[model samples]
Target chain A: MAVDGRDEMRPEDARIAALYRHATGEMPPERLDSAIRKHARAPKDAVKPQKHTLWRPAWRLPFVAAALAVVCASVVTLLVERDGGRLTVPPETPPPDGGETPPFSVQREPPPFSQSMTDRATVEPRSGRAEDAPTLTRKRAEPPREAEVRKSIPESKARIGERSAAPPDGRVLGAEPSHSSDAPASRGNKTSGGNAPLAYSQPPAPATSTSPDRVTAPPAPRAEDDSLSKALPAPSAEASPAAKPAPAANPRPAPQPESAPAPEAKPAPEAKALARKRLESTPSEPRVPARVSALIAELENEPPARWVERMLALRREDRRQDAEALLAEFKRRFPGERLPASLQQNDE
Target chain B: MLAYGEGDVAAFDELYRRHKGPLYRFLLRQCRDGAIAEELFQDIWTNVIRARRNYAVAARFTTYLYHLAHNRLIDHYRRRAPAALVSYDDEEASTSIEEIAGSAHERPEAAYEARQKAARLLELLQALPTAQREAFVLQHEAGMSIEDIAVVTGVTRETAKSRLRYAMAKLREGMQGWL
Candidate 1:
């Protein structure tokens, strides 16, 4: 017969039979019972993670903190760099003193001579005769008072000079030679009671040589007259015919002999030496020979004052010729080296 | 005493007292080696202790206990060396008491035959394919229904029923004349 009957028997029949037989039988060997006990005891010392809690992965907390830190740092750095770039734009509106635009307005004006001639013409229409001029006539009549006034002028004039130097229009005061017209009135006032004629006269010589003749000559003549009023009358027996104009007013000229000597004691001599030193210490362009550099270095410490005076004299005679001579001398010394782009051109 | 959910040693000992023998016999029948059965028995009880926090009172205690035992036996089969599966050939010559029934009542002959039959039954058990045997033991010997067998084997009731039916048919056919 087919075994369907056995197959269809209840699921528990086999287990119940096995259990009944097992219950009635002798107990299993003691060794078997003890083995089960030993198995349970073995795992007591094992240190597994607690069953309900997930294992604490050792690297996880530090890893998360480090990742967050890196991301935050990157974001902060990006924001700072971005803000810096936007903040760096050149200021659109200039400061209170203004900027570079005013100088171009200056360069567009008429020639320097024309500007000085205009200033002199404006002041001259109000001027009295040469002998009756307010500053000069008063100085000739009252010498001691003139000297006191002249001394006081420097302090007040220094303040005015500072203001003129900082023009409201933002144009630099000395940008053009035409402004030299403004200097004569101030210098003439200084020379009116002049104890040191050379100090007052030396400035005019440089001014005359540097500025255009039309702009500087008229102002210089005024300064010379101011210097004459300080002279004492000399005794007639010893006076030369050449000194007559000054000796008539200066009945004793010996006390003022020091005025003529002041011009000979020049301070620009030191300034020239310092300028040369600056040039020597500033390294020449790389192509110049070492021998030429050493010569230049020596020249820097002790500039030849005679050469600068000769050069200025030559410039008065002919500016282009003086400039050519200086360039030729420089070329002869360093024929293979090119001049710096700035130095190749004159300061003018 | 610590509660059942606390994983306390005492709670676990009580759990062991309630189910250890049945689970041990179940593994012995499933593995057929005293050593392997003993090893599997300990492993099953250890898994019970380990999973103590996960246990609840929703089902019979035996169902939960035998489910753990069945799972461990399946795991042992998977872990066994390839040569161990092949060693079933050595067990082919052994047979069950159900195999020699006519003279089984003859005193010493019956005693000897009974012992041989028990040995043969174990061999037949080992000879069955792992899935069929697992289904058969969990259902018939563990006293689990098809649904309980499915839960233990992680299979559907249909699959457990099919496996049990096949196991029973094979055993019935093989022991036809002897039984």
Candidate 2:
């Protein structure tokens, strides 16, 4: 071979070249070639390409691990969402087209209290209508301005004056006279005579009338009057022979018109008192004991349904004496009526 | 080469026949032992066969082959005890020029002189340092250019050329009368 001119060959290069030209290393024995050829042909003799791959065994572990990790992550995400009470629907998407709102949406405002009362009136017409008519009358009577004006008045002083002044009008005697006007003439004198003393002896009428005005002024007293009017018919219907007594009692009518003016003059105290009296008198029972009357007066602001619940709560808090007294008064006021299950359970 | 990689046994056989003699001689001269040379030769070709499916023709096949051989030799040297690599310069010089020259007879004398010269040349080649010997062998035996030798041996062209020069100088000094 010719040497590159760039490589300046010493004389030794030419001599070494000449020596190397005549001599090369000995060839490997033929057996080595035979052995190597046999090795190279070994796969061919089997007639199959190698099933093994650099990727196969190595890839399996990583792929399996990745798949398992994906599954585990999915499971954990679902569990966490379920435990947290999160809705499955994505936040960005609108909920499925059911008429109802999605669980995550803000809860709808509760139906109005008046709307619920009207609904109850429709559901149970007998007692509910009677109860609802007075409430509706009360709602209609008190203008919003008058209620706001009443809120500024000292409620306790107003209630005390109404209670103290009520007996002199002889309104308690008039309730009996009104009963006589509705009752039969023969029974009217007898019923009227019996009621006049009872009315005079227990000046509960003034107390009851004063409570309504104290608790709820202009509107509620109007409701109490409507309720009392409604209540008068019930007893007359139960004892029509006593109806003649109502007309005889009606002839001496000092208290009849006074009832309406009493509510307008002291709306809060009279409304509260009237509500308590209406509630007690609506049933066949004629009178509520003084203790029960006081208890009912104390709870004048609370809905009637909650009275039992309050008594039971008092008992549960270990106020045993107060609970027992309240329960006994409730039983006396509502004789022959089934007590609420919660109150009964607590009593046992 | 691509066909050989595709499992064409005949193709591989042709490739083997073309390169085997030079490659075997290359390893044999480097190791200066028959068993080790055969072992290295088999190992290199086995690697070639195994690497076939992934083989891309990036450079000349010979350059690629010698590159693998170069790396294998380095690994072999590392594995051996240091004492095994004591210099063979004195041993090579002990063989006299007259012994290498022999007589001036026609056929037998010529044959005797040829064998003696071959033995002496091998001794000189073995006495050279590993890098220089590799450069000389790749140049003369494999017929690789300086550039190819540099590529195969992982060095600059100038380094490969210098190694070849040093190796040639050493051989010439050892066999001056024969030249």
Candidate 3:
């Protein structure tokens, strides 16, 4: 018969155990024990790892220093790879030169979205952020509206704090920062310079950034033309393209007339003198494009991709503190957006 | 075991001296064949020696030793094919278990009874199914608690307890008139 297997302690368990032990008092013979003991005693059979002096206190400092050096070098290499080498980096511009560029600007050029957006959307201008995030919304609503663009012109110019300060190098106001003929920057600039690059060919033209031709830096009187003409730099005729067809350096001639009278006439003397001094200070450079104020507005409007590029530039320079701060701001401004491929891996 | 893992031969000798008898008797009762028991006994010790360097103090050394014994026994049963050892979850494994016979199984019951009381007990032990006999031997011989028995045998604690309860009940009933 099969027993019902109930799992409970039995009162007779102790008795059964005692009786079983008494009945079966069997043990392994001495021979088996001797054999096992002999096996255990086999020479060098055990696996013991040998201790090394690397962990000693004396070697600690050198080890730590080497580790730090490796880490720093890796970080530098990663940043360089991310931002690109010397050719891609924009010139170092002071905060005033930043001209309301976003809180972070590894770039000196106006980003694609336009300096209008970059200038108006200042990171430090907390008052403007609520307004700035919605600019894209506003642009989306009335992207090509002349009336809308005109309406935004005054407000944008008003927010432009350092639009007057320009890159110290005589590079054209809106031209590439490192535009040496041999460098890749020159090649990129030639292709990417757009309609404005020809206008900015001579850095001397922006020297007249003193004018309303400076592209609405002074809050121009002609609202309609200045609205659309704001995208053009007033004095960028390196090809003398402005002299013949440009009707004198400023491409959009009508707005320039009013801007020239109202804004340029006022600072024309002081600015020209300052532009001349800067021009003399840096001979080999593009020449004082101090009037890059228009370009300043342009640079401020750069895209997230541009900002990331700049952050990489900062990192390549081993400027980690600045890079970290810029990256943090970039993340804050563009939350939930997937970073570019270069930054995405590092982001994760 | 830890000392032996650190290359102390004497520690291994001490462990062998302390555990050999209980382990040997366990195999002897489970197989009920001296030669096979001796073979398994030596193999288990050889395994212990080979594994000494990798041994960790994760559980009682005795439990580790017994776990090795249980696995060896399972392997032995597997080698002697056609006598498939079903899981303890299946209670009706007696038919196949009878095929796991030792030379002792052929001995006459009359001869067993006529001998000493020890022989009578051994005879009753051999009469039970393989798993039941194993449960009884592990409990009474190694003095393992139900929990240790479950871990060593790779079964649940409740199943180990039930096997012990059922084995003891059956053993007691077998010796009812004689004891």
Candidate 4:
């Protein structure tokens, strides 16, 4: 494997040795300088050296090239194979010896929300889930008063009308046996009007595992209310004959089947008034939750929480005007709530 | 060379002044043609200038310089087109021979004798293989060591030694009483 060039070398055997010694003997130190200068200054286009000076240290180049190639290949192979032919997951720390490794990190799946986001709106009903609802106000009292609001609302209205048409209690406040004439309108509300928006909002509530109280939060209540008001007539309109029961308790329930259409007559104006009236009437603390304020602060510092994404999705679906109207109303109602940067940027 | 390697242009000029004559003489002896010798000489010096920036203390300055020269000559022959070596006509041959014979610039008798001897030596040298001639010239005329010669000739020291041996034996046989 190794070539030993000097082993059997003999000075006399090589006349070259003698010639070289003789030739060099005649050369003075000054001559070497002159020759080197003349050679170095020679124009490149001129003929090459009569014979090249460099012996090449012939293996040096190949050895260096091979070493470089090995280093590069090893680096590439390490990148490819170390992760079993998948993309490399760079080591979290660089080697202690201080050589370069890639500066990259692999993305991991998002953390499960229920486990991590404990304070989220997971407790509310599917229809008016608080998380699905954008926060339009920031009252310190909303969280504590949620149950009270649910209790105060007409239970019949709260029944999320689709799943079970049967009354929670057999008491239908007022139902005339001959009242079958107007049943179609009530069914229509459930099928096509306010209840339609209600049903649509409900899907996100369950999917997002958020509460309806989130939607009803007074801060951005108008958009939430608008969506709700749009969804309301659907269920109300869809309520079938089965949903219409005979009078059990009082006459008010009887009128609801009739007055439900009243909501349809001027829903747009009424929903806005209802939201304004609710904001004015409710106690300051109960109107907006402290948690919501904290979330607002967090969003102001960072980006908006999840509902902003839904809003964006809506915007992307050619609902830009709707989204803009809702966003402006939300910002107005929740004066201090921070909008996400993208929304803020768009607004500016 | 050391001074030149350190960037002294004066040193470079001095080295040029010092080595040019000897190198020219060596080239003249090896090539037997003034034009070829001058050309090879120029090449050797030009190479020295090009390599000065990278120079280290390698062997003696003399060895390095001529080592470059020795290899340049070899490369020149290798690179020359085959047809370029066409036989010279009588006039050109005689003129070249006379020039070579006149190269000894000593006293008349000594010059004549040295010319005859050099002529005879050149004839003997031409009879030897290229490798042998190169080895002999580098060793005896250039005064390079077997090791340095190996470096210049791109051969093993053993090979250089073999060529020198073969060359010497032939010269001894061909010019028995000449030296």
- Candidate 1 regions exceeding 4 Å error are A1-348, B7-11, B83-111
Error of 2 at A253 (Å): 90
lDDT by residue (tens digit), candidate 4, A30-99: 5544455555555543444533434354657888899999999898777534322111111122222242
The 10 consecutive residues of candidate 1 chain A with the worst lDDT sum are: A103-112
Which ranges of candidate 2 are over 4 A from the true structure?
A1-3, A8-15, A42-348, B85-111
| Candidate 3 residue lDDT tens string, A1-348 | 112235345545554565677777677777877887877787652323222344465678888899999999999777644432221222222223223322111111222111222222211122112222333334334323233234433443433333324422221323212121111122322212121222233234332231222232221223332322333232222312322332222222111222222221222233323432332333233332343322222223333444556667766877666555566545543332244455556556
TM-score of 2: 0.39
lDDT (tens digit, per residue) of candidate 2 on A55-156:
566779898999999999999877654422221111221222322121110111111111122222121111111221333334334244233223423443
RMSD of each candidate relative to the true structure? 22.7, 21.8, 18.9, 19.8
True contacts kept of 2: 0.56
Tens digits of per-residue lDDT, candidate 3, B140-163, equal: 777777778889988888787778
The global C-alpha lDDT for each of the candidates, from Candidate 1 onward, is 0.41, 0.51, 0.49, 0.43
Candidate 4, after superposition: displacement of residue A261 in Å? 56
Candidate of highest DockQ = 2
Off by over 4 Å in 4: A1-348, B83-114
TM-score of 4: 0.31
Better of 2 and 4 by TM-score: 2
Top candidate, metric lDDT = 2
Q: Write the per-residue lDDT of candidate 2 for residues B60-153, one digit (tens) a residue.
A: 9999999989888877877789977533232333334344334211224356776666666777777677788788889887889989999999
Sorted into a CAPRI-style docking class, model 2 comes out as acceptable
Predicted complexes: DockQ each: 0.07, 0.33, 0.28, 0.14
